[model samples]
Target: MAMAVAAGCGGGSDSGDGDTVKIGLLASLSGTYEAVGTEQRKGFELYLDTHDNKLGGQKVELSVGDEGDGPPTAVPAATKLVKKDKVDVLTGIVANGSYKAVLPLVEQAKIPLVSSNGRPEVKNVDRLWHTAFLSDEPGAAIAEHVKEEVDGPVYAIGPDYQGGYDELRGFTETFKKAGGKLANPDGKTKWTPFPKTTNFMPYFADIAKSGAKAVYCFYAGKAAIDFAKQYAQSDVADLPLYTAFVTEGSVLPAQGKAAKGIYSVLNYSADLDNEANRKFVADWSAKHDTPPTTYAMASYDAASVLDKAIAEASKGGKEVTPDTINKAIDGLGKIESPRGSWEFGKTHSPVQKWYLRQVRPDGKQLANVMVQDLATLGD
Candidate 1:
């Protein structure tokens, strides 16, 4: 609905000018995913601030555009960033639909999109790279664990969209393969009508009647908060909850007591005990009151990837063009990230470790505590 652009001191052309490299950030700055967009922007800016606003040893000029919620808003914003701003590279699409919508535009323009959030399955990935995991990865990573932990069948549910379909499929397919069963009627994953289905009481009641031992689902932003709060008061509140994205840092504080004891699977958590994460948390804490979410971590990693790619592309007097950057990205062996070291897989997403986390009390506040490493997953 609203579009905002900020330009730095640089030319608005993709000529690979040695002085500055222009980057476009398309995010949901308004609508349902606004919180995620804010975190994504902050994360990328933090990387720039620490690196002296440079990527690949070149000063950077950033152009930001609001992707809103879906294709309608995202396509227009992306067109402007590519056609008008002439960004050398693009980054920061929060929603899967937005990412899918702008794929053709980026591919046609021959610009690399270093996405910082979940993406749907796609065949041509020559110009697409994601710092975030594939949409189904989190569920897939935790499926075996959930299957072993629960004695009976698990109920799967999520928003009715491409993202939800991928997420639930990851769990159901893996769970069934691992000799697990679904408790939903006729062995189907329940689908809620997405952003439209705010009240989840009906779904909870269905879960109770299905005789499930545990529940697996995915929801983010406001939907996640609403689900957590309402689930706490539902008849099935005592059932074990297993999920991805529902209890992330962005919504955990708002979910509060309702989110406690919920188990989640993700690639990064603030409590991860690693040198990169320690520095990342300390640096992030200096500027933010709340802990950084995976949205922030993934976006921050996107910058790290670009930093290396740009520098590699600029080697031997070569111009830092999109083609060069895309090639450079393919050769970046491993990225040192807040989530630990990971490299781009065949799918152009991260081949990395996944962790099992539980919402627990951290001193006075609740946080997603890293329980243990679940599995290493990717393409």
Candidate 2:
């Protein structure tokens, strides 16, 4: 994997005393989750750019490393950031697998690790908090929507991994609870080779044979792009597709017309009617020339949370140490985010509204438009 380091030195004050707060970010800069990592990095960096790269009136330095696709590479990267770079805190993990690999070292160092994309609720480790959506949250919300709106058999498909299991399980359990049934419970409801498969035609063929009225799916990055395009060209293209993280933001731009009319439940939407989101999209568009994705919003929120915590810690004229930062974050009741106002749950995941969105034309470009305000689902 490749590693890149960028210090936010120019915008913030050059106190020149070596007192810059170092924030280590571990993300997939290459491999399967690179697009996710790129957007996440931009979101975090955008916050710094807008704020003049200062947090709590202190200069901030960001040290970034590619976590690749798994823990083998991430563990060493995290270790280097903590032991060698002596970073004050850690943030930005794209894959849950990477999070699992590097978490032990983070706990040992006792530094606060704020997750931007990693599923935080799944791991019970201390010194870690999630500023991103729980992996199953969007699934649960979609389940609730399906139970209330759709009828007949519902089928599910996802990359065969722990996250895929969690996503599908989250949907199935809630859908059953709300009185929905699977098309084939005992018959291959789950599938695999998550980061391995590129061609999903076989999966789509199986979905067609399942005789389900609706289908729920979860795929991101290149896989998501291919699935949307291929699904649109498939026999079941007209079937109402309900999904979580299956469409929106980065993926939506690529999916384009193929993604039109697809419904999804997620925490952040570019079309959200709120002051914070309006400003976020406007500023993000001005800076990146692209609409912000949920991944970006998550990392952006991570930065916001860190800024608030650091500012709170500075009230006493104290340096923003790990403990002080954590305490400050703990004291915070709610964060006004681009997604909306949300509070960190007991599990460190955000308890926020899950928006039901549909891919549709938004004047010049295709985008995920808010269809309805779905239920809040998180730990």
In model 2, which runs have C-alpha deviations exceeding 4 angstroms? 1-18, 120-125, 185-188
Clashing pairs in 2: 160-192
Worst 10 residues of 1 by lDDT: 1-10
**Taking the tens digit of each residue's C-alpha lDDT, what string does model 1 give over 167-259?**
889889999999999999989899999789899999999899999999999998899999999999999999999999999867888998999
Q: RMSD of model 2, in Å? A: 3.4
Q: What do the candidate models score in CA lDDT, each in turn?
A: 0.88, 0.79
Tell me how far candidate 1 lies from the true structure as C-alpha RMSD in angstroms: 2.5
Q: Looking at candidate 1, what is the lDDT of residue 290?
A: 96
- Give model 2's TM-score versus the native structure: 0.93
Give the best candidate by TM-score.
1
On lDDT, the candidate that comes out on top is 1
lDDT digits (tens) for residues 314-357 of candidate 2: 78566557777877788888899999999988888888888888
Could you tell me which 10 consecutive residues in candidate 2 have the lowest summed lDDT? 4-13
How does each model score on TM-score?
Answer: 0.95, 0.93
The regions of model 1 sitting more than 4 angstroms off are: 1-18
